[model samples]
Target: MYLYYSFIRVFKYLCRERERRGQTMYLRSAARGFLAFLLLVSALHGYHDWTVTYTSSTVCALRGSTVEVSCSYEYPDKLQNRSTPVETLWFTKEDHSQPGGLVSDTDYAGRVERSCEEHSCSLSSCSGNCTLRIRDLRQSDSAEYKVRFITNQPGGEYTGDPGVKLTVTDLKVKVPHWIRLWKYLECQSMCVLSDHPNYVWYKNGQHAEREITKMFYIKEGDSVSCAVEGSERFHSPLVCAKGIKNLCNKVTYSTRTMCVLQGTSVDISCTYSTYRGLKLKEKYWYAWSNNNEPTDLQKDSEYKGRVQYPVKERGGSTLKITDLRDTDSAEYRFKYKSKSHEWKSALHGTTLTVTGLRVEGAAVAPVTEGQRVTLSCSTRCLLPGQTSYIWYHNKGPVAEPESTMNKLVLDPVGLQHAGSYSCSVRGYPHQSPEETLTVSCIMCILCRD
Candidate 1:
């Protein structure tokens, strides 16, 4: 069962690594081919008893707050009876030169804790769970975390790969737009908080009735801010609701930053207002240039075919970019022209980050017959939603029981499985670099003996 699980993990690693590295199409094609072969092998073997399951694959938390990541694991009772756990560790980074680095050894030294429980399960298996708690979260603490345990048996260490991803974000008070009557304000973060925490609103630097909601209303000229209920110290920056006179010249973006996968599409939008009765002459989106000037995206040759200005309602405009490329990453600002005035705020605009997928692990490795193998798909940033991955062998797609799964497993590998492998996100053309799988025949070794 452990062998079977290991194969699955390997496949997942390959897929993930490929996406993260954003390798070229040739490499990605080869890696997909290898992953497909592994998936075929695992499908023939069926289920495995050894497994590790995380309560949540992704978590979002506020800076300065506390968070807990938990998972449960199961192993065959036969191994449990003969082997005892020698070590258990939780880590954000894996060190190939040694065992994985513990969270405690990192900057989290005084703020991390771990707890575990173990018990027998149905006499044929043993089950256990472990929870990792991190306090006073820092923005730098955002990372993918994995748990590993070692047993007394030879080659008895296992790690939960494609582990939990943690995102730490600061609070921001979304300024109310004129359409909302300039009365409502919202507390925002990059990702949804895992705890679904209550929010505390502040008016003019003072607690506003200890408000327990994410949205709030403010009077003209009043400044509003927000924080998690118990974390008032980390409140968001203040935003002034300065009436029409101040709002008439302002532009407000829907978001400050966006992370997207290469080959995907993204839309960045904003709302703007001009002095009353001013005839709007022109409106457009532009990216910052090295010359300290804003170049209209529509006029730029680089964005000619890929850029579109989706017509929006009265005060809103959207910049849509399709088939995203890494080179597209930049700060984008919105500008509008009136007959007598041009509005372009000194404040920063939206930032877009484009990441490509790359498969990780060795490009070529010799596998002995009957050895378990795994491949994985990965990305630099934890993708926003559940991502579906496609595996390829040689140059064509590989058939698998679960087409959406990012992992490919080969249990008890055979010579027929040797090939070039690659992986890609479903619905996207980008793929990870190819990985070559080489198989060594066990019968040949026996014959020599």
Candidate 2:
């Protein structure tokens, strides 16, 4: 704020000077160009100095445990170089400046080095990754961290000068701590919602920079990797998401975390842009079935006993299930609803390909509360990058304009998600039978006595 105010004063002074000499044409033109150049330089400076991105800023950690802050960077081509290695300093802005505060100053001297392999200004190392470990973390460590990188720009270089801040909070961890007690755990992770100043994640052993939910599950022998770099799954092949963690460079500080299950509790999460999410009031977690009806698992008994929405800071929705079984498999989904009544859906579906089950499963009825479930049946699909996908469920018509694919994810499937799902490709002019879809699924019991 101090620098911002100082810059504003200088900017105003410069403008006043230009106005004072407006009568001089030559002076006016020169001043205008000078101002423009300054503005561009300012933007560039802010771009590098102001950025403190994380692969996965907020990490979900168990209470009375440790959590790491994965902070990374992306600088302009000119400003970032290997010889003049950019020094990343992690500390509390004002609280503790005694050369230390949350993360030890000397701790990351060697391990938290920069990576020149990918992004010239990337942060990574061999000992592990660019993760900041917080030991004996208190409930307060659940706040954003002011992560800054200090580097000098040549005196005449057209570089930028800005400060970078990344959040480092320990959002509540999903699933019981006992689950990871005694397993090599090649897969599976819980949600950790937080508004850290800067946050990032290193799954397996690489920088999870993209913010989308890239499921680690792959086809047989497809080489499901434990390294964060190996996660290639993007579209849920079920429901699309709004805040699905994409590991991309985003302007908003808020984020989402999605978990994929092979045969158990499925947790779907979404985080919004940072500042706008401060006073979180309502975060509606929605789902659909094969029929495309909206369903709220929060109130439904099917989820009432097991589902848990742990975000109390800036409201968020969480769907948790226990007693992992084949029958509990289904296309689980969710979306975000804010205070202004604005709505955006990142709903997704997960087809539980039940391999081992006794009785033929049936569609679970949306018990008497008369709730709503959203069945995504559109031909429009958009990926993290460019190019979109189409969605379809049951025999619904969701294409008017050109759509990517004829795929739809049935969320919160009650009796509707139970219907025979199919989708007709878009741009085919007529709903051709060749482009139709038929969802093949098996059912089972959710809980055992």
Candidate 3:
């Protein structure tokens, strides 16, 4: 403050001397310009001490989360002081209009502490400076905040501004029990508690802007998280936000780990406590085929892997499998009684299978009318082993002379033979879709169908 005031004073003296000496016009103009610059810098800082009536802001947080409220000021250089003259008192305004007392005086002044701050705001650049940090958050502490500035100048001590409205909001989360998000599946989920349109999701503490699966879908490896509207991501337990009602509200997320089972392989893992560190257990694999059936302990017809445990030294019976087959899939059951008499029953069931598409070139096309003809066709069982085929036309099966195998034969060909022909092969997964041969002038016969 003194430096700028001194510069202004010197500039005014120079201007007066120039006028008195009838100095060059340039000299007088330079003095005036310097004085104006100094004054502008000082006046800009004064704006910071005004009422916070320009904009109303809101902040959203969680039950046990923290948030920072920012305040900036612009004022004249002459008004700044190096020492903390006027105390910066930030308090919750339960109801500024209430003739009664506030409700949140519960050790708030002590629990709240500033985590980030800045006062470098020059009279000119400090327009966006002041801020306060509050931590160890609680839901009951939610309310509006009011800030006031006091200054003790050489002339007198005074106060500036009042009721800088800052609305506090809360966050609510419902992550029921176990949640299993799928792997390798395009999946995303979020916990939203912001009024802003900007939505964000996080997994393992990283920004996931493209994820749309917000509490929408679940499969295996993935977990769920969220953010307040203005938040970049919910990297923290609570999501802080602005521009919202119930503004400080926030929720956290968690997910259940997956139990992966494949046709030829069963890979299981559990998080618990063990002595020698969790390892494999020599146990029989038992499972049912569908949801309707009760859990069966009768050993499966064919099993691939043993019961595996995750996070060594934990007690859990999870199954893992490799080199699987279609029939190897079913509802698996396991039982574990800890060393103590405490026995708990937990069941995790999932049916696993791989989707496959196959195409087997049929026998050759029937003979063409105008050319010496040759006919060829073939039948195949797309699934692993069931090999059986049958030919069908507009009606049902065009069975052979009471034969066993499926076959296709072309008679003396002609223009009329150039019609629709189809073949059917059966077994495994689901039924195979019918493939057709649309014989165009298909001597030029390259049918896409």
Candidate 4:
């Protein structure tokens, strides 16, 4: 699962990069073809005899959360008849036959759990598939894990090499020094989280709204912190915005992140200030790119007619993008220079995500009558503001009162529910492409006989 998830993240990142650069369809095709080749290689490597296949090569899990490492193994079926009894062990240290190197023998005694496909062989014997689970993970638990199986037959001892590596990390609130009215705080981790979990924010120990952005203004004494949605107890340390004393030479954005619809317009704004005596020389907005020097948006040909820097207000600047495209998604930052000093926040800038609506769960195999079906309005990221959904049946609006919900669930669906469906958000003019739902009835087929 981790390997597959990693592939998905890579693919999405590549796609966004290509789209943002307005690359040709050929490039996109090449990316997909390369990914397919990798998948084929992985499949071939996993099916060989006397092989152990792990779900993921590496995993990054949050500290305090449970971690499960799973693997499946295959050996000659002849081993089933052996009388010596097979022994399987999961360990992080050097391999030992059985009684020595197991995780249970280490510091993880109470928190470690081992399970396998064969329940009868509980102590250490297992065949086919096995899993190791650890609770209340700590940073010290980060290590390479392997499973070794031993048999009485000559040359029957085998250990899976290059085992899964686990990295445990804790969330931290990154506070950026900003002299602007808006202060943006980021919840950061040392490793990328494959699941892309939702974040929960807290202000002065009070829960904040789900839709609030990190760019929201903070009062002088207010302290803010964040945690992953499911693990609120393990939140980051609260960092007070007022505690930042050296805000004299910093640039800060209006928001740390945004998700906007395609074809719409967006404004990426920021404010900056330097030491009292420093003279302002230049100020501009630039999109971040790998190993490339920042260039002014107004001078970039890629954004020829689409980008504009509106009139500056006091100490603020805004980059207005019109006729937005999916390729416009990128991290943008503001920079200012004085005669003797230049400043751009060392922290990351605003991340803009452009997305389109789509109806999911519509192309499943035909649903049988009397079975429930759910269709959802899906977006890459949540859109800004109070978002309400509007559903459509065929080309007309759905008359059901609950059609306003993001999900349309039909309980014990009937033939009448079969049709083309689409969805759109309220206040947005665009609607998703139509998807057909087919319902099959056993009674109707019997009646025909």
TM-score of each candidate?
0.50, 0.23, 0.29, 0.48
Better of 2 and 4 by lDDT: 4
User: Who wins the lDDT comparison?
Assistant: 4
What overall lDDT goes with each candidate model? Answer: 0.73, 0.37, 0.40, 0.74
For candidate 3, lDDT tens digit of each residue in 1-449? Answer: 78777876787787788889888786757867776886787687554444333133556554434566666543333445454343345555434633211222434522455422434445422232445666545556666665544444343222223433333443332344334442222221222344434445554224454433244343222233454445332233432221123122121213112222122344544333222222334322346333443322333334413333332333334555555545554444443333432112122323344323222332245444444332222311112222354444433455452222323554544465444444444522222344443333544655643
The runs of at least 3 residues in candidate 4 whose Cα sits more than 4 Å from the true structure, single-residue gaps closed, are 1-247, 344-346, 401-404
In the range 16-73, model 2's lDDT, one tens digit per residue, is 7767976456556656766786787788666554344566634554332445666555
Candidate 1 residue-wise lDDT, 1-449, digit = tens: 56657766776776677778875674566667767877876775434555678999999988866899999886555554454564568887757835555553636644677888864456666678889999767799999998887655445667788899999999898764644443556788999976677888766445565544434555554556678876655667657676666544556678766778888899998876654546787888998664767778899998989999896688889999999988999889898887877764435567787888665543365878898887766665445545677888786777672344456787877887778888887677778888787888999979988
| Candidate 3 runs further than 4 Å off | 1-56, 75-84, 93-106, 115-128, 154-449
Task: Predict model 3's lDDT versus the native.
Answer: 0.40
Which should have the higher TM-score, number 3 or number 4? 4
* Residue 158 in model 1: lDDT: 72
The regions of model 2 sitting more than 4 angstroms off are: 1-50, 55-60, 76-82, 93-129, 135-140, 152-449
Error of 4 at 402 (Å): 6.6
Worst 10 residues of 3 by lDDT: 249-258
Query: What CA RMSD would you report for each candidate?
Result: 22.2, 26.7, 27.3, 24.0
Best by TM-score: 1
| Order of models, best lDDT first | 4, 1, 3, 2
Superposed by TM-score, candidate 2 places the C-alpha of residue 402 at a distance from the truth, in angstroms, of: 73
Instruction: Tally clashing residue pairs in candidate 4.
Output: 1
Cα displacement (Å) at residue 118, model 1:
23
As a TM-score, model 3 comes out at 0.29
lDDT of 4 by residue, 345-443 (tens): 334577898998888887568888898888888887656545678889878887773333467888888888899999887777888888999999879
